[model samples]
Target: MERIASVDEIPTKGVLFDYKEGPFDEQGILVRTRDGFKAFKNECRHLPMRLDDREPADIWDPHGRYLVCNSHGARYRPDDGLCVSGPCEGSHLKELPVVVKGDEVYLETDKIGGFFNV
Candidate 1:
């Protein structure tokens, strides 16, 4: 696992990750919830485009109840990364494992991202 960012750095809404390993690049989103934190690849189920196509902070729905895709108005629940409405309904966002230690957050690059597998 590699420390990606501080827990404090993540906003209450969410944040985008430009995760890269050698030539492998994947966009991700991290959302902090009352239970803890949830992370998922930024790709939407209906398309190859990112959910945060406009901006990371803009992913939230109008009422801030879910993560809204700017392209097709898809809404994903922050707690479970599930699409509740839109073209991708019934599909799930690809979840990534995360660990929170003290004030820092680390991505399980090996189990999920293959960051330093050599």
Candidate 2:
């Protein structure tokens, strides 16, 4: 059930896709890091707000290490899915398991909530 995307479809940094239905109500930003492709639920743990409120852009930190919630200054490390700051310090970015097959990227839709405790 992984949603596949071509390498061209995804930017070198990352791309945001809106997930209005299915398991995720909010959008998810997929990043192409040194490790591999990764995605996270695009909502801030604090105040239950969308992370990209003002800019409506994909959530990404200047350092490229974490996706940032600019609204409340929350930072989520893309590597291990940890919130390093803000009210949701102990919380983590909802991880979306993904795989890159050849030039396509797919998300494991079946295990969305169950695996990540979403």
User: Which candidate wins on TM-score?
Assistant: 1
lDDT of 1 by residue, 25-101 (tens): 88778889779888888888899788877655488887888988888888999899889999999899988888899
Error of 1 at 6 (Å): 1.8
Off by over 4 Å in 1: 54-57, 116-118
* lDDT score of residue 77 within candidate 2: 79
The alpha-carbon root-mean-square deviation between model 1 and the true structure, to one decimal in Å, is: 3.3
lDDT of 2 at 26: 61
Residue 84, candidate 2: Cα error in Å is 1.3
| Each prediction's whole-model lDDT (CA) | 0.80, 0.71
- Candidate 2 worst ten-residue window by lDDT: 109-118
Which portions of model 2 show Cα errors greater than 4 Å? 2-4, 20-24, 55-58, 113-118
Clash count per candidate: 0, 2
Question: Residue 76 in model 2: shift from native, Å?
Answer: 1.1
TM-score of each: 0.86, 0.77
**Whole-model lDDT, candidate 1?**
0.80
In the range 1-118, model 2's lDDT, one tens digit per residue, is 5564687888666777655334546667787767887887777778777788867455777766677887878888777668998778979877777788887877776666432222
Error of model 1, residue 110, in angstroms: 0.6
